[model samples]
Target: MDQSYKKIEKLKGEKLIEKLFSEGKSVVAYPLRLVYLKTNFDAPVKIKAGVSVSKRNFKKAVDRNRIKRLMREAYRLNKSNYFNNIPDQYAFMILYIGKTKTDFETVTKKMNTLMDAFLKQQSLPKP
Candidate 1:
């Protein structure tokens, strides 16, 4: 796997986003929360991710963009940790939920923890 966040790996399109929100399940590790849903969209990669920051918390575009940048970089670097074991395709939305800005180290640490939680979640049989 390339392990890079390519344009094709970006989760977009109106219909797809709507379906994800409506059908996805979520896992959280403070400052970050991941909502993911199994996808049927044709694609080269097994996963596609979207990052978000609350507009209410970060009113400036710059602030939101900065946080998203950090989140993406963290995910990109550590994605391989659980990427190979994903048995199926999934679209993911990662949300930043902190009331204040946090450093890259904190975000990266939380991102790893979040992915671990997600992998563990996927391992258990669905109810």
Candidate 2:
């Protein structure tokens, strides 16, 4: 399990992002929200993920960028544990919804909780 977050694993494209928000399901854990959509990719990867920090909340590019960086690092460190066994490819957008700044420890803890919630939701029988 490679812990590095490579450029190829970064989610991109405007249309795909729009579709993800409009059609995807989300799981929230405090400041973090994981919005996921099952989708096929030409690339040979199990997941493509992106992180976001709201400009409205942070009001500064530096603040937003820092939060995004924290979120991405948390995801990169924790993803393999949660996603390694899954066979389907997914697109994930992790949004930081809190108003204040947070530390890496808090982000990592919340990320673990968020991923647990996501996996629990995934295992449920769909109606």
Candidate 3:
């Protein structure tokens, strides 16, 4: 099966985005915060994900776009490290929370940190 991620797989819509932010629990790992919800879809891969950067932190559209681009790139390259860390079928959102624009190298490092945190979260004993 082709595993290339297409944009359509991304979680969108006002209501869904709201759920990820409010209803879903969050875990912070420096540049990114993982907001996740277990999904009804049968696939083992993440059904959808959204990446966001705060405009309040980055006043310029170019800087915001640049950071968003780097976040997406990091997700694209390192997504495999996290897909199995989550539940078999789930949708996730990783929000950028840093106050400054960052280079791709920094974004990628943050992605790795987030994924490591995810693994730690995954291994915790359930109540």
Task: Output the worst ten-in-a-row residue range by lDDT, candidate 2.
Answer: 118-127
Which pairs clash (backbone N, Cα, C closer than 3 Å) in model 3?
A: none
Which residue pairs overlap in candidate 2's backbone? none
TM-score of each: 0.93, 0.95, 0.82
Q: Residue 11 of model 2: what lDDT?
A: 98
How many steric overlaps does candidate 1 have? Answer: 0
| Candidate 1 off by > 4 Å | 124-127
Q: How do the residues 41-92 of candidate 3 rate in per-residue lDDT, one tens digit apiece?
A: 4334455777888888988999888888888788877776556434455567
Candidate 3 Cα misplacement greater than 4 A, ranges: 1-3, 42-45, 84-87, 124-127
Determine the backbone clash count of candidate 2. Answer: 0
Flag regions of model 2 displaced more than 4 Å. 124-127
Error of 3 at 45 (Å): 4.6
What does candidate 3 score on TM?
0.82
Ranking 2 against 3 by TM-score, winner: 2
lDDT by residue (tens digit), candidate 2, 21-54: 9999999999899999999999988999999988
Query: How high is the lDDT of residue 91 in model 2?
Result: 98
* Model 2 lDDT at residue 21: 97
